[model samples]
Every structure is written in C-alpha cells, then in structure tokens.
Target: MSNPADLGVSSLVLQTAEGGDINPVYLGIFVVYLLLVLAIGAWAYLETDDVNDFWVYGKRLGPWLATWSYVANFVSAVSVIGFIGAVYGDGYSIMTGIIFGLMLGVSGLYFVVHKVRELNHVTFPDIIAELTGTEVARPIAGFVLLANAWVYLIMQLVGAGLLVTVITGVPYEYMIWVIGGVFILYTVLGGLVSVAWTDLVQGTLMVATVAVALVYITLDLGGIVTINQQFAALDSGYVAPLGDGTYTGLAVLASIVAFFGTIFTSQATIIRINATDSIRTAKIHLAAAGVILAVFYTMLIMLGAGTTVALTDAGLTVDNVDMAFPVLITEYVPTTIGTVIIVAILSGILSTTDTRLHACGVTTARDIYDYFTGGEASDEKLMRVSRLSTIGFGIAATAIAVNPPGTIIGLYEWRAVLLTSALLIPVYVALYSRDTPGKAVLLSIILGTAFGPGWEAFGAPFGAPPTFMGVGMALIGLTIGHLVLKGQKETPAETAVGND
Candidate 1:
C-alpha cells in the first residue's frame, strides 16, 4: 500500500465540501449492520413479556452465548478505543492494567457469580437488599449503580462519537445523537435479551475482525520480528516494557486494582452473570470470557503499537492517539476490509452501550421505582417504566456526551474505581456474613463512597488509589457498625425465588 493520501478519489468519500472523502462503501456497510441490529431488537421486544425477561434474559443462556456476551460486554469502547489509544500513545507498560487487573478481577468474579446466581437477584440492589434485609439499601445502591451507569454511558457515547466522526466525516456532536438513539431504541424495545443476543453476534464479529486485521498487518509488515525491528529502528522505547515512563510502577498497580474492582462489581456485568442458566454455566463461561478477554486485550494493545509503526513508516501523522486505529484502517487497508474494521469498532462501542442502558433501566425500575412504590406495581406497569427509564437514561447520557468530559480511559477509571469501592465491601458482607446488620451495610457503603471521592479530592494521598482508601474505610465502618449493633436479632438468609 502506498500513501493513503494517494488512494484514488473513488476509494474515499468527501469528508467536507473543501477536503477529503470517506468511503461510501464503508458507510453502506455500517448502515446494513445497524439495520440488522434493529431487526434483532424487534425480535427481542416480541420475546420479552415481563421485567425478568427484559432484565435478565430469562436466565437461559448457554455456555457459548454467555462466553461471547461476557467478552463483548467486557471489551467495550474502553478496551478497544480508549485503552488501545493509551497503548499507542504510551507503550507496553500500559498493557499491565489489563494483564493484572482482569486476571485477578475475573478470577474474583468466578467466586462472586456463584453467590450472585444463588441469590436469584435481578439487579445489584437486589443482591444487597436480600442480604442486608433493608428496603432502603435498594434505592441507595440503585443510585450508586445509576451514577456508575450514567458516567459509563457517557463514556460510551463519547467513544462512539469519536468513531463515527472519524469514519463518516460527520461532526462528533451530530454523531453522538445517532449513536445514542440506536442504543436507546434497541435497549428500550427489548432490554437485556436484546443486549445479550446481539453481544454474541458483535463479539464474534469483533474478534474475527481483529484477528484478520492483525494477521494482515503482520504479514504486510513482513512479520513480527521485522515489525519489532522496524519499531526499534524508529524508537527503542517503543518496544520497552515500560514505555516512555508514562505508566509508573505505582500507576500500573493502581490500575490493576481498579480494573479488578470495576469488572467484579459493575452492575452491567453482574446482570450478565444473572442471565446465565446456572451457576456452573456462569462460572465456566465467565472464566472462559476472562481468558478470551486477556488474549483480545493483548492483541488490541499490540494493534495500537502496530498502527503507530505502520503510520510512522507511511509518513502519516495523527493529531490524537485515539484516532490511530480508525486512521490506520481507513488509510492502509482496502475499502472493504476497512469497512469491516469500522463495524468491528462499532461492535465494541455498541456492545457496552446497550448493556449499560439495560443496567440503568433495571436499576430505575426494580431498585428505585418499584422498591419505593411498595412493590405492588403491575408487571406491565413496571415494564413500561423500565422502557421509559432506558430512553431517559440514554437521553441523559447523550446530553452529557455532547460535551465529552475527558479521555475515555481517564473518565472510566475515575468512576469505576469509585463504584467498586462503594459497592464491593457491602456486597461481600451480604453474601458471606449473615450476622452483619443493614445499618452496618448502609454505613459501610456511605463511608466507602465518601472516602473514594474525598481521597481523590485531597490529591490521592500517598499516591494510593481511592480504591484502597475506600475499601479500607468501608471495612472499618463495617466493623464499627457491627460492634455497635451486635445485639440486634439477625435476619435469616432469604431464599431465591427460582431455580435452574
């Protein structure tokens, strides 16, 4: 391939009246893919008759579907776009977070899922409430879950906007609405059933696309050894274990802990676990997804490095590292192949977006609305509220996304670490300690939640992450609250409603 700037006019579409063109064929492929997604959403809507089906996919997922869905949900725009961009901008050391974070994080989830499924809960709040035996815990956890979802949703929309704008030559502000609307439509219509099934398809496509892209790029550049030699020739640091000193040892460690916290406790992921047909199935598929994600993330990080090397060789320059993958595909690959890569990027973005939407809806309907409304609302009415909440949340995310807060990785890390700190300890107590009181659980969440943001506001004392302080505060609060309320009668563990 020669300079992408020299590709024939017909191979690209006009980006603006005054300048470059985008490939129409690429846009055509994108349109077709979205239509297929809409069709799937319609099918899911017809299948969903109640809140459980909407929220948990009727708990009937097989191992393969579960595995793919889990991977898809885990590798969202954050992994493919944000983290990959960081790898390109930084280096190999950036990869440590996925390596350490996911290995430990997903391992913990294996234990957590069995307990989660045994609880037979529909949302994160249900898990906390069931164990703590407090109605107030439901809405409090719900609010935290909603806050997490809201920030996460904004992150997805921002990534989507970046992708669509770069690929289609449209402005990001216009692109976010289109992206948000599509997510809202599918999620509002069909809920988690729609999200899970579509994830299977999106996951497969993304993996296949990356595999093809990697193989092609490697072969085109001569081979792995040659690519490494070329990178060393450009800059020895490009191949260094700790690239450019951007990610210090402490930063990597904190990222690992934070990633672990996020994956194990994210409501979107918890719901994916709940969607499994059985606890055994959830464990098998989740573990498989972890291994698969580790591999995919490794490749994605390399892909970023590969893009940088290729661009350096081609004499191309990107203003932002986040733009590297998109620019690489559009400039270096054939239009048809580039189209597939574009869809792959969209697949990563949309997979996470839909699940976040479902999570917000479930939190709103089950945890906040229904719990506060005395739990007597009709299924039909609750389902209606769920649908409305999905749309509402989508709109809110889009509004916030119109002005992106920051880099996808930065914003995601800030919010995820906080949620993990606030939610993880309370959940651990609920699942394992039958003697802990609701008051203690509630106080722990409050203290943990407060400590995370407060520590960050205080400049992250000792260079320690909020996760350490937050979880530590939560444990301390838990012990004190338990000691203070030790004489209260213990609540019997509640039985889950359904079985495999």
Candidate 2:
C-alpha cells in the first residue's frame, strides 16, 4: 500500500516538476509577507493615538475594507486547515455544511447587526451589559469572549508555526515562540487599526492564492465532472440530500440553527458588525461578507474534493487532513509558485492571530477590568492593561499550541461548541429582543453553557452527536428561561419601553 503522505506528495511533485528544494524561496516569501504586515501595522499605529483608535479603529472602517476584513476574520486557520480537512473526511456533505452555515449566518446578521448598532457598543461585553443592565453580564461575557479569542488565537498561532516549520525546517517550538512574539508586538502596538488594515491585504492574498490553487487542481483532475465522478465512486454519502439518513433531518436543522445562533452570539462576528461606521455600511458590509465567505468556502470544499480524488487515484488516504493543502503545495506546484502559496497561508494565519490578540486585550480591559471598577479607568490605564492582558493570553495560547491536546479539526470543533452553546443564545436575545429579561438572559447563558459542555462530556440518553446535544439543550434552555421570565408582570409604561 502506498503511504498516504507519499501519494499526496507525489501527486504534487508530478504537477510542478520544477527541480530543487524550494524551502529557501518559501522562507523568503514569508519574510516579505511578514514585512508587509509589519508595515501596515506601523502605519496603523501612526494613525491610532487613543484607546478608541486602538480597540475599535475609531469605528471608522468603510464598507469595502470592513467587509473584506470581516470575511478574513471569519476565515482563519479553520477555513484552510479544519474545513478542508472536514471535506477530505466527509466529502461533498461538507459543501452542504458550508452552504447551510452561510445562509443562516447571513440571515442572523440582518437581525443581530441592527441591534448591535443600537447599543453603540465596542465589544461583545458592551452589548451584554446594555441588555442585562447588570454589571455581572459584562464581566462574564468578557471572560467568555476572552476565552474564545484565546482558543482561536492558539489555532492561528499553531497554523503559523506549522507553516514556518514546514518552510524553514525549524522546530515547531521555536516557530511558536517566534510567531507569538511577533504577533504580541504588532497587536499591542497597533491594535485594531493595524489588525483591520493588515486583514484587508492578507484577506485579498488568501482568496487569490486559494483561487489559483483551485484552478490548478481542477485542471489537473480534468475539471469538475471528473471530480464529481471520483467523489461519487467513493461513497454514497458524498452527495446525499439534507434529509438523507447520513446526518438526519433533525441533525441538519440543529446544525443550521447552531451555525446561525453561534454567528449571532459570537463576539468576534458582532464586533466586526459594530466596527462599521453606520447601519447602512454594516448592512452592506454584512451582505458583501456573506457573499465573499460563501465563495471562498465553496472553493475550499471543491479543492478538498479534488484533493481527495487526486490522492485516491494515486492509491493514498490522508490521515492528517490538515496536511492536504501543504502536501499539495509542496509536491504539485512549481517551487517558486509553491513558495507564494506558503506565504499566503502565513498571511491568513498572521491576520487572524493579530486580530484575535487585539480582541482579547480590548475585551479583557473593557469588559472585565473597566466594568467592575465602576468604569472609572482612564483610557491610558485601560490601554496599558489591554496590552498586558494580550501578552498574557498570547503566552497561554502559545503554551496550548506547543502541546495541543488533539487534531486541529477537533480543537476547532470544541472551540465552536464552547462559544456557540454558552454565548449564542444570550447574544441573540440581547441583539434582537430588548424585552428579554435579565434573569432569563442570565439563566439561558448558564444553562446553555452548562448543558452544552455537560452533554459533550457525558453521552446523551440516546446516541445523539455531541454537537446536536449541546446546541439542542442550549436552545431548549434559552426558550424555557425566556418564557419563564416573560411571565413576570410589569407596568404599562415599563412594558411599552421594553417593547421598543
């Protein structure tokens, strides 16, 4: 039997055939990418002179730039490493997964963004505090946001380390330190202004790089028809309908709900929505981001399918799904071109890393420290704390990345479950229905978070998937809590204000 790695690598080699190890060239490209990012960061630092500038870019981002940055922020290490790996394992069902998630996300945004705008909040915790009118919600939401950001930051850091290790023949540990150090500096110094601008550049490069790779892979595999035939031959589950027995109608519905719910609740997603200058810009940017993400994820799914076919034809099976793109780039593309792809991967990883780090800092300072301390903290003090907290979290994430507990896909899934189950319901209520009682919101968050993770740890009564169990319980808990709280009486005047 051919080694899976050999099969994948051999196919890549066959495509390029440009002699010589291209690691040096790849390293050079990576240097250039890093330099470009640094330049953007430096420029942003010059433009930013206050805490608002640091945390929210003074809420001045326009539609196009904000839209691209939003898309880029949403598509991080997971889009390339985790999502593609998912397709490699699950086949065309992955495309359905992407579509279902995207559609719901877009719909959820329409409702959520308007509410977020009304609150005039900068971070996720700000929206939570506005809705609950309780200081507790701010700190809790901040902690959750910080945790989610840290988990995502680790993923991005790991992806960056992996790229550097692969390109420079360096140890993963060293690469982690190097990437972490650079990210901390840029993020602390430049803040959101730097992160957003860099994201714009990196996002464009990432899309272009993926497009080129997809085109090359499609042509190599004799186009879409042949690709579909190959997948069809692999498994009947590859192209089944949403209600098909493979994943079940209920599960599909739950997945869609979870996707929509998560995006609506997610601080990362909402922060981007809040970052836009106006409601009109937010709407336009949200729509544009949805379209861009749909296109990018669709192409990724196609690329994954194509890669699966190519590998199978060569008598290989991928064990490490995250390796799919890297294997292809190194083996199939010309050395010089392959180097560019590597740089693109690095760009994606760095853009995400910096954004998440900045988010962690700002969320911690604003949501936790400033909230509990009676909001008396000066911007300079908050900014200092934010920067320090960012460094602290970066260290923690680097530690986790150095000793990852599971596969990249598994880590991403766990992070998604954690963030979606606990925070999604509360976020949605806060954004859409102002009448949702503070007690209900708090209960929903506690129950959803507890049940979501609990169900994952202990098996469900039936043989339900963990994700379904978590999200289902979260929704049920939120509904019950909301209804229970809704029964409480209020004066006619109070009711009218709540209704609005």
Candidate 3:
C-alpha cells in the first residue's frame, strides 16, 4: 500500500517530489484564483448601492446565473471530498443521505415556490416574520440562521485551511487567515451579486472538471462493470445495497430529515428563491440546479467507486478516507488536469463559504439589528450595517476555526436539526393553515427549536433522531397554543384568507 503521507503532512499538502520544497505551481494557482475573486468583489461593490442590492441583487437575477449560483454554493467541498470519501468507505448507501436526500430536497423546493415568491420577502427571517405576523419572528428566525451559518462558516474555514495546507505544504495557521480573510473581504465587497456571478464561473468549472475526470477515470478502470467486479472481489459488502450495515435504516432516515430540512428551511436556500427576478425564474433556476446536482452527485459516486479499484491496483492506501478523492487525483490523474480538479474543489469550498458568510451578515443586520432599530434605518445605514456585519461574522468564524474545540462535524449535523425542527412546521402552517393563529406558529417555532436540542442532548432515546422529536414537540406546542390563543389573534394566513 502507498504511504499515509502520500498526500501531505500535517496539512495534507503535497511537496515537490525532490527537496521537499513547497510546490510553487499550487501556490501560484491559489494566488491567481484569489486575485480574480477579489476583482469580482470590487466590481460587485459598484452594483451594490443599498441593502436590497447587497442582499439579493435587488431581486434581479435571471435563471442561468441563479441556477449556477445555487448549485455551486450548495455542492461545496462536501461533494468534492466528503461525498467521494463517503462512497469509498460506505458504498452507495451513503447516497441515501448525502446525495439522494439533497436531490429530493431541492426538487421538493418546487412545491413551495409559489408561496415563497408570493411573499417575495428579503431574507428567510423576513419570510418567517411575515408568515408568523409577529414582531419577534424576525429575530427568532435570525438566531437560527446565525447559529447554523456561523458554525458552518467555521467548518468551511477549517476545511479550507486543511485542504490548502495539504495541497501546497503551507502552514495550517497561515492558511486559515489567508483563506478566511480573502473570502470575507470579497463577501463584504460583493455581497450576493459577487457571490452569484462568481458562482456561475465556479459552478461551470466544477461541472466541466468533474465531468472530464469521471469519464477519464471510468475508462481508465475499464468501465463501470469492471469497477463493480473489483469492488465485490475486495468485499462483497462493497457491492451490497446496504454496505455491510455501514449505514442503518435509522441513520439513513435521519440524514434524509436533516438534509431535507436544510433545503426546506434554511435562509441560504430560501434566499436563492427570493432573489430571483421573477417567480418563474425561481422555479426554472431551482429545478435546473437540482438537475445539475443530480448529474454531478452521480459522477461523484462513480468516481468514488472507481477510486476503490485505482487505489488497490496502484498499491495506495489512505489513512483517512476523506483523502481518497485527492489521493486518487495525485496518483492517477495527469498533473495539469489534477491541478485544475484540486482548484475546483477549493472553489466549491469558497463558493459555499461566501454564501453562508453573506447570510450571516444579512441576518444580523436586517433581522437582528434593523428590527431592534425600529426598521427605519436609512438605506445608507442598512448598507453600512450589512457590510460591517459581513466582516464581523466572517472574522469571528475564522477566529474560531483557528482553535476549534472538539469535532466541528457535530455543528454541521446540528444545522438541519435546528432549522427544520424549529421552523419547518411554523413556516408551512403560516403559509397554508389559514385558521392557525400566528401565536400558535410562534409557539411551534419556540418549542421545536428548544426541544430539538433537548432531545439531542438527552441522547435521542430509542434511537429516534432529535430532529423528528423536535418536530413532535413543535406540533404539541402548536396544538396547545392553538387551543389557548386560537381566537385571540388571527394568523397572517387567516387574514389573507379573510380578505380574499
């Protein structure tokens, strides 16, 4: 087997084959890419004149740009590194959570597109507040967005630092600041305009590179049949539907809920829909992104399966499976092509990081700060606050990434739980349940978010996922509140219905 250090040392970066010097090629590539995005940021700044322009490009994005932006932002390095590694370790079963769940979730977004565009709100928190008809709904949803996004931002910074360090032999400490500071700078400058436009390029790069890589690797391994034969030869479980129980029914189901909930409830996804130039654009772009992701994730799975055969034949072994994608590239891919693939992976990481970081700033400025300030802050003041919040949130996430305590993966898992459990029912009922009081929805959000974490903390008794338990608690809260406050104040939905 190949060495554990084949990829890189502490940073998992690769050095020159001789003299162990840093690879100038990789370093040069990193610098050029950074400069390009920074340039885009500067241009996006001109387009950003007010809070509307900054947050959602004044709701002017068309289908192609919107589709690519959502795809690029959502895919992230998880597809590049984690998903491949997941398939490598657990076989196709991991797809139930990571790939299929995301696919279904995005497609399912269509069901609510009409309601989302009808409201035509600014932020996800704005939707929550508008739906709930409560002054505090904005801040409550803001907290959810901030908590999830901030931790996710930290994870991206952590992952990027580690990835760059491994690829270039740069010090982990230095990479964190450079990567974090650069993205934050651009995020502050460009906002969503910068993010959406740059993602068009990034998303295309991702698809083209992966498409080429998947084809080449599959042919190299003598096609899919040969690859499957090799998998079964290594371990029958590898070819099994369940992959030797690597993922249980409960686990797979949990993943579906978490992933589904994320797309269903998160500010990040909702912002994409709300930012479209028209409701039709929202529908077309979301559906397009989902289709692209379907093809993209399928390629990743095939690549993962192919790597299994390639590594074995090359006598390569990865100490950590997450390194499988990079390992395969270094060992099997040609230098020029492999270099582009690596950069594309990094691009995936940055695309998502910038989007989430942008969400953080928007949430804080609009949902938190503006709400407290009587919602009359001048466009000038809101713009200023939005930029400042972007910087503040980005820097904070970076600082935590520097000295993160324990495993950060837990933070990623908690995101969907909080977003979906806490807000899913509330948002839906607010949209559809005409007779349900706004206070009932409010109670649902509070109870669901509250007990969602409580169930998680209590160890998810009987193996039930905490997210579902939180949903149950939320339903209970809704019922109780509906019974008590049912006639006190009509819901926003009810008021709309009454007017109709």
Candidate 4:
C-alpha cells in the first residue's frame, strides 16, 4: 500500500488488484441506495394526500430535515463536478470565490425567508403573483424557473450518464436513458415527498463519504502537511489566495454577484424555504444549510487539489478533470471504501436530478397552468398535467444532455444570469417592501429579463460581465420605475387597491 508505483493504472494492472473492477460493487451499492430511496418515496406517498402534500410536504417539515433537504438540493452536480473541476484547473482562488459567494447567498435568506414563509404559497410563481398583483407575473416567473431547472437537470443527468460509462463501461446513451427513466418514474410516482426524503438520505451519505474520503486521501498523501508541501512543490499557485490568472478580478466579482442575486431569487432554493413548517424553522434551516454547504464545498476543493498533485506526479493525464476526485478515491482507497465513494457521487447526481424535475413539474402546473386558468383547475387535473409535463421535460433534458451545447459550467453560469436578471428585484421587493407597486415590479422583471439576454447578445462593454450588467439594469429600472409611477396621480380605485 505504501508503494507509490501501486497508485497508477499500470502498477495496479501488474499487481492484478481487485480494485480495478468496479462493476459488481458499484451495482450492489446502487441497488441498495435505490431500494432505500424507493422505500422513502413510498412512505412519503402514504403520508401525502392533497396537492399541498405532494408539492410541499404539507408544510410540516421540521427544522433539521428541511435544512438537510435544502442543503442537499443546493449542492448539485455543480458542487461535485463543476467546483472540483475548477479547483483542479485553477486552484484555491476558485475556492475563495465560492466561499465568499456562498456567504452572500446565505445572507440573502435573512432578507426574504421570513416574508416568503408569511406568504403561505405552495409554489414560487404563486409568490410572484401574490407580490405583483398581476396574473402575468406567474407565468413569466414560471418560464424563468423552468428554464433554470431544465438546464440544471440535464447537467445532472449527463453527469450520471458519464459516471456510469466510466465505472461500468456502459454506453453513455444507454445510461442516460436508463438513469433518466428511473428518475422520472420515481419522481412522478411520489412527487416532492419522494424527492425530499431521498434527498435527506443522500445528503447524509454524501457528507459521510466525503469526510471519509478526505481523511483517507490525507493519510495516503502522508498527512496534511505533506499534501500541502507536495502541492507547493508542484505549483505554489495552488495554495495562493488568488487564482493564477485563470480567473480575473472582474470574473470573481461577477461570480459573487451572480451567486447572491440568484440564490435570493432562484425558485428552487426559495421554494425550499417556503416548504418548511414555520418562519423560525426556515431561518434555522437556512443558517445550518449555509454552514453545511461551506464545509462540503471546501472539502471538495481540497480533495480536488490533493488529487491533482497525486495524479500529475504519477504521470497521469486527467482528461476529464471532473472525474479527478473519483479516480483518486478508486486508486488510493481500499476497494470496498472506493465503491462507497462512487455510489456517493452517483447519489449526488440523482438527488439533484430528482429535485430539479419535481420543481419543473410543479412550476409548470402551478405557475403556468393555474395562473392562466384563474386557479379554477382541479387538483386531479393539475396533477395529471404535472406528471405529463415532468416526462416531457425529462425527455427534452435527456436530448440536451446527449449533445451539450457548451461547457457544463458555462451553461450553469448563463442560466444563473438569466434567472437573477429576471426575478431578483421583484422577488426581493415582494418579500421585504410592501410599497413596491405592482406595475413597477412587473416593469422591473421585464427590463431585467431583457438586460440579461441583451447584454449577452451585444457583448457588454466596460468589461462588465452579463450577470453584473443585467443585475445593475434591473436595480436601476426598479428604482426609476417605482419613482415615476409614484409621482403620477392615482385613480380612487387604484388608491384603494394600494391601501388594501
């Protein structure tokens, strides 16, 4: 085990180590995890009866469980693959950006969670409609949320398909179809109940797996000091405060802005807060989730940095930087433990996919359908449409996953821009400021939406990233629109409506 030569593929092949073959162990752990997930789904289904139960667990979830579920939902394919890939490529600067960015997101909860809990809405679009006093806002918010959720879901499915192909030699196409189909079935069968419960379990396992892997990797590298020394020997930049020119000052600032703006407005994260039992619970959960996310992401960055040193020194080429963490685990850890890490990674992907799909379905039904139809739709009818929409969206995501349009990280960042621009201002005003006029709020959303896509198409000048530009335009529009509208004379009926 002390042999450095034993760490590479060539040496392992010569030793005829059982560690190389992951099929049986991977399949076994997956089966167990699947069974546990399905069982939880079934339990949740038995506990739920109405649409509220299906969508928000009847708003009865406790602090700890809700907190765990929220944290799990937030840490998606981005945490596992995107963050690790960034660390491997750019080093500690990426980690610094993420830590500060995440703290900004957590602070956003303080501004909005209590108000969101007060609304008592079952869906994100419902909150929008309530805030803006316009039916149109619901569908617009729904579209933005749907776009973000769909893109994120596809990213998770694609990651799962890739992981399966790498570990089991399955065709990527087949794995995509199989993984997507299973997720759709489980999600549609149990809805939010299934997603939440499964997330809780996956979240626990993932934390344990990452902690164990960190300890094991540290020991294998001859402890923390040796690991740091080795990293410095390779590239002192790895441990530096700022990245090695890979990410610029503007890019880092843009990242922080996007993180804060999106987390405050993103339907996926906000809806989790609304799903909790009470305002106190929501706040507690948000604080706890913040801490958990900070630790989990920091561990991932460290693992990525460590594995980069270990692999590079052994003359290995990490073609897919996203796989660096798993590759290191399998190469260095005992076979049984390695299997657990692989399953944990797969669990991360599946947890994210399941929650995203559920959000998409709920948004389509509640935000789009109920709004247009004047909330007259029967729960049965809406549920039927929701299930069908989930399948349709799942298929579309699978297609996109099969042929990704850009780097997964780029796709995610762009989606965040779109979401932040479109919904951030309106959502914040709705939660905190009662004076925000409905007309002004609607105008802000429209302007913000335009600004994001507009800046991207026009190539933002002043070296401003689209995320910053869009958010800036949104805030400006919001402030000016409200002032202009406030100066105008109000009709007697309009005055009455405002007072009400």
What Cα-based lDDT does every candidate model obtain? Answer: 0.77, 0.71, 0.77, 0.73
Mind sharing the TM-score for model 1? 0.91
The superposed Cα distance between candidate 2 and the true structure at residue 497, in angstroms, equals 17
Q: What is the lDDT of candidate 1?
A: 0.77
Alpha carbon lDDT of residue 342, candidate 1? Answer: 80
- Model 4 ranges off by over 4 Å: 1-22, 329-332, 457-462, 487-500
Model 2: residue 23 alpha-carbon error in angstroms:
1.6
Q: Encode model 3's per-residue lDDT on 189-295: one tens digit a residue.
A: 97899999889888898888888877887888899889888877887767665667655677677768777878888787888888889999999998888888898
Error of 4 at 445 (Å): 1.4
Q: Taking the tens digit of each residue's C-alpha lDDT, what string does model 1 give over 219-318?
A: 8788877877776677666677656665566666766776777776788887888888999998999889988887887678767767778888888876
- Superposed by TM-score, candidate 2 places the C-alpha of residue 340 at a distance from the truth, in angstroms, of 3.7
The parts of candidate 1 lying over 4 Å away from their true place are: 1-22, 232-240, 490-500
lDDT of 1 at 127: 79
In terms of TM-score, which candidate is stronger, 1 or 2? 1
Q: Supply the TM-score for candidate 4.
A: 0.90
Please give the ranking of all candidate structures by TM-score, highest first, separated by commas: 3, 1, 4, 2
- For residues 1-500, what per-residue lDDT tens digits would candidate 4 score against the true structure? 01111123222222221223447666666667667777776776677687777677778889888877887787777777666766676677766665577678787676667887877777777777666666677787788889889988987876676666556645566667878887887888778888888888888878778777778778777887887788777777777767665567777787777777768776767667778888999899988888888888778777777777777766666544555665665555577767767766876778889989998888999889876786689989888878889899998998777755544465666777888888777667755776677668778887888888678668666767888778778788888878887645434433311110
Q: TM-score, each model? A: 0.91, 0.88, 0.91, 0.90
Residue 269 of model 1 has an lDDT of 82
